[model samples]
Structures are given as C-alpha cells and as structure tokens.
Target: MKLYNDTNAFGLVSRANHWISAFLFIGLIALGIYMHELPKSPEKFELYDLHKSLGIGLFVLMMLRLVWLKISPNPEQISHNRFEHILAHSVKGILYLAMIMMPISGWIMSNSGGHEVAFFNLFTLPNLVGENETVHEIAEGIHGTMGPLMILVIALHIAGALKHHLIYKDNTLKRMLGKK
Candidate 1:
C-alpha cells in the first residue's frame, strides 16, 4: 500500500491512523461506561487511572494524526450528492472536535479534582488547572455528556461509511480501507 494519499483513495498512513484511533475511541468509551459504576476501591482507582492514561494517549495520537493530515492530504469524498458530502464532512468535523475536546476536558477534570493523571504509571502529566470543585464539576459534566454523545456520533460515522459502501456502491469506505 502507498504511504501517501492519491486523489482517489487513502494511503496506508491514513488507514493506520483511522483504524488505531477508532479502536482506541471504542475501547475508551466502553471502559468509561463500565468503570462508572464500580464501587470505590483500589480496583476502581486503578481503572480510573488507566482510563485517564488512555485518554492522554489518545490525545497525543490525535495531535500526531493532525500533523500527519497536514503533511499528507486525505482523499476526496466519493459522494456525488452534495448533501451527503456535506453531511459526511460535518460528521467528520464533529469527530475531530470531540477527539480534542474529550481529552482536554478530562485533563481539566482531573486537575481540578486534585488528581494527577498518570500515563500508564510511566509518568505524571502536568496539571492544567488548580484544584477547584466548580471547575471540576463543569469539566466532569462536559466529559460525561461528550462520552455518550460520542457513541451516537460514532454510530453515525460508521453508518454513513456502510451506506456509501452497501447502498451507494462507492469507493468511500474502500478508500479508507486502503483499497482502490
């Protein structure tokens, strides 16, 4: 597979980034939901730390992905319908926004709650804000709201890809899959 995008299809780098980010997002979302109800204990704390670490990892990966996109432009959308094209772009924009917002909000939430975000126990990340219950609550609310909403947005993204592949019989999904 090619490393850079052509006019018709995505390259290996884009496909790798997309698939890695997709799996990470899904794992983080599932972990977030599952660990929410765990009773307070060592295990819960461990899981929360894991979640924060993974979130930070995702943030770093996304920053790198953005840089990669700038250096290697993505393939054009294959949709012929203007509305479908617009909607596809809109959903993608929202996904990118969420990818950035979720991690920052989580970092703020952790810092404001007087918690250190340890990355896989390798090192601690710098605090973004001083301890403040109000800020903590607000950030918490944003993170909480974004998590569930992300599920819906991700569903829409996947559904759109499937629609293009199955219903429209286009190269939209194939391009992302690194196929011609």
Candidate 2:
C-alpha cells in the first residue's frame, strides 16, 4: 500500500492511524467503565494510572493524525448523496472533537483534583490549571457527559460504514482498508 493518502484511497499512515486509534479508543472506553466500579485499592490506583497513560497516548495519536491529515489529504467520500455525505462529515466532526476533548478534560480533571497525570510513569504532564474545585467539577462533568456521547457517535460511525459496505456496496470501507 502507498504510504500517503491520495484522492482514491487511504494510504498506510492514515489506515494505521485509524485502526490504532480505534483500538486504543475502544480499549480506553472498556477500561474506564471497568475501573469505575472498582473499590479503593492499590490495583484501582494502578488501573487509573494506566487509564491516564493510555488516554494521553490516545490524545497524542489523535493530534498526530490531524497533522498527518494536513500533510496527506483524505480520499473523497464514496457516497454521491449530499445528505449521506453531510451526515458522515458531521459524525466524523463530532468524533474528532470528542477525541480531543476527552483527554484534555480528563487531564484538567486530574490536575485540578490535585492529581498528577503520569504518562506511563515515565513523566507527569504539566497541569493545565492550578487546583480549583470549580475547574475540577466542570472538567469532571464534561468528561462524564462526553464519554457517553462519544460512544454514541462512534456507534453511528460504525453503522454508517456498515451501511456503505453491506447495503450500498460501495468502497467506503475498502478505501480505508487500502483496497481498490
């Protein structure tokens, strides 16, 4: 496969970014949900640290994806229907926003809650803001709400992709898969 995107199909970098981010994103969601119910313990703390580290990794990956997109533009939408194209674009926009918002909000929540966000225990990210209850609560609220909404949007995206491949019999999925 080509290493950069072209008008006809996604290239190696884009596909790699998409699949890796998908895996990490889904893993983060599962990890977050599983950890939520855990009682206070050393294991819970370690899990939280892992979650934070993974989240930071995701944030970095997304930012890199954005840069890669700028460097190598994406293929055109396979759908000719205006509504379908618009809807797909909208869902993708929300996904991108969520990808960015989730991690930053989590970091803000952590920092404002007086917790250091260590990236895989190698180093701690600098706090976005000084410790403040209001900031903490606001970040927490955003993180909580965005998490579910992100899941919904992700589901919609997957469904749309399936619709394109299974029903429309188009190259929407194949293009991303680097298939002709």
Q: Local distance difference test, per candidate?
A: 0.90, 0.90
lDDT of 1 at 19: 93
Per-residue lDDT tens digits for candidate 1, residues 1-180, read 589877777888889889998998999999999899898999998999989988988898899889988988887778768998898899999989988999999999999999999899899988999999999999999999999999999999999999989998988888787666
lDDT of 2 at 39: 99
Task: Tell me the tens digit of each residue's lDDT in model 2 across 45-67.
Answer: 89999999999999999999999
For each candidate, C-alpha RMSD in Å? 1.0, 1.0
Worst 10 residues of 2 by lDDT: 144-153
